[model samples]
Target: MSQKKPSKCKKKQTDEISLSKKRNTRAGNMGIGYETAADFAKRGANVIIACRNKDRAEAACEKIKKETHNQDIHYKLVDLSSFASVRKLAEEINQTEDHLDILVNNAGVYNVGNQLTEDGQQLLIQTNHYSPFLLTNLLLDLMKKSKSRIVNVSSLAGMAAKMDLEKLNKYNNFFTDYALSKLCNIMFTIELASRLKGTSVTTYSVHPGTVKTEIIRDSGLVAIVSRSIIRTLFKNATEGAQTSIYCAVENDLEPFSGEHFEDCHMVERYKSAQDVWIAKSVWAKSENVVQLR
Candidate 1:
C-alpha cells in the first residue's frame, strides 16, 4: 500500500481502485499490498481488494475501513492459479462496478516447484504472469471508461532474465523461472501500453525493491540464508509499496506510460524488456495461454 497522500488528479466520489491478490501472495496482510490498499482508502477512494482467501479478505477490509474510516473498502474472491476464478471475478467487477481507475497486479509467487495449475500452465508462470495478464485484459473495457493506470509489480530480478519463450512453461531452476515471470510482467506492460495507445489508459511496470515478504518460498540452506539476509537488509513493506502507490496516483505519469519505475520514479527498462519483438511475442503467447482470442 501507499503513503496516505491525497491523489493529485481530480477525484470523482465514485473513483474506484481495483487490485488483485491471492492466498499465498507475499504482499497480502501487512505486506506491501495491504499498505498500498490502505493508502488508497485513506484518500477516500473506493477500494476493492481481490484475494483468494475469504477470511483474510474480510478481515483486511474491516481493518482498512476502521483505520481509514472509509466504508467503501471491500473485497472479492479470486485465485490467480485458475483462469476460471479470474474470469469470475472480472465478470463480477464489470457487472457491479461502474469504473476501475487503478489496477495493481501486485500478487505473485517466487520459487514454487515445477507444477501446473488446473489450466495446465506452469504454476509459477500462471500465478506470476499469465493470470495477471488475463485479469488486466478483462478489465480494460471498464478502465477505458475513465483515465486509468495499470501497475504491474515487476522485480529487479527481471533484469537478469534471459527470455526463452519456448521454455516459459518448463522450469529450469527456481531463480530462472521466477526471473522469467518478472521479465514477462515488464514485457506485458510494454505491449499493453502499445495496444492502449491513444486511449485514456496508461500502464507501468514497477520494481518494488527487495522487500521482505512471504512470496519467497525457496528451500535448502542457501535459500534460508538468503531469506534471512533479505529480511535484515531489504526494504520493509511500507518502503516497498511507495512506487506502486506513486504509479497509481502520480498525475504526470501518462507521458511515461510503458516505462519501468523504481524508487517512486521512472527508470530505464531492462535491455531485454525493451525488445519490441520479444514483448509482442510474449503478448501473443499470453493471449493463447489465457485463450483470449
Candidate 2:
C-alpha cells in the first residue's frame, strides 16, 4: 500500500513557519539589509533597523518580524546626512538599551549630484563618513559598556581615493567625494580599533563586493547604461552582507581589530589608507566636526 503524502496545506504552513524564522536566505540586492537583521534576530539578537524613512523602516521591521517571528526587531529613523538626526537617534538608543551588541555603519549614499549638508560638508561625505564617525563617538560609551562590535561597510571605490585635506569637499569632483568618504570609513575603523584596544569593543571595515542597488540610480546616464551590466556582474545584497554578518557575529574576528576585509578575508588597505599620518589627520578633523555639535 502506498503511504499517504503530507497535505499541501501542512507543507505550506511548515514553509511559512520556517521562513518566519529566517527569511530570504538567498542573495538579492534589495533586501540584504533586512535579511542581515533577520538573521541576527533569529540568533536571539534585538536589532534596530535604522533608516532615513520612517515608513520604510517600519515596513522593513514588519517584514523581518513576520519572517523571523521575532518581535525584538524594531526601527529607528536616522538621516545620516544630518548630524542632528544622528545625535537624536544615538541619544534615544542610549536611553533605551543598556547595551548595543552590534553597530553596523552600513547606510550610505553615492552618485548624487553635488549636495551639501547643513554643516556645509558634501552630502556623500557627510552621510557616508562624517555622520557615522560622529554617531559612533557619541555612542562609544554605550558600546564600551556592552562590549559591542562596530562594523563599517566601506567600498572598493575607496582605493581610488587620494587624501586631499584641501579638496576633501571635492568642490569640483563628486566622485572624489564619494571615494574619500569611503576611505574615511576605513581610516576611522582603524583608528577607533587602535583606541579601543584591550577593551571589549572592536572595529572592522569591509569592502562589500559590488552589488546592484539603488545607489547607481542616482547617476542618470551612467546608471541607465550600467544597470544591466551591474545586474549581471555584481553579487546580490545578501552576498554583499555576508562579510558584514561574519564580522558582526564571528568570534574569531574580535581579536583582529582594525583589520580590513573583503569576501570574508582580511586584505591590505590602500597605501594612503594605511598611512599613520593620514589617519591621525583625519581623526583630528573628524573630532573637530563632531565637537561643533
Best by lDDT: 1
Regions of model 2 farther than 4 Å from truth: 1-31
Encode model 2's per-residue lDDT on 115-171: one tens digit a residue.
Answer: 878888878788888888988888888877755788898999889988877776656
**Model 1 TM-score, 2 decimals:** 0.89
Q: Highest TM-score, which number?
A: 1
lDDT of each: 0.83, 0.74
Provide the lDDT at 41 for model 2. Answer: 64
- lDDT score, candidate 1, position 42: 71
User: Model 2 lDDT vs. the true structure?
Assistant: 0.74
Q: What's the distance in Å from true for residue 88, model 1?
A: 0.4
Residue 141 lDDT (model 2): 85
Clashing pairs in 2: 20-67, 28-237, 29-237
| Regions more than 4 Å wrong, model 1 | 1-30, 217-219
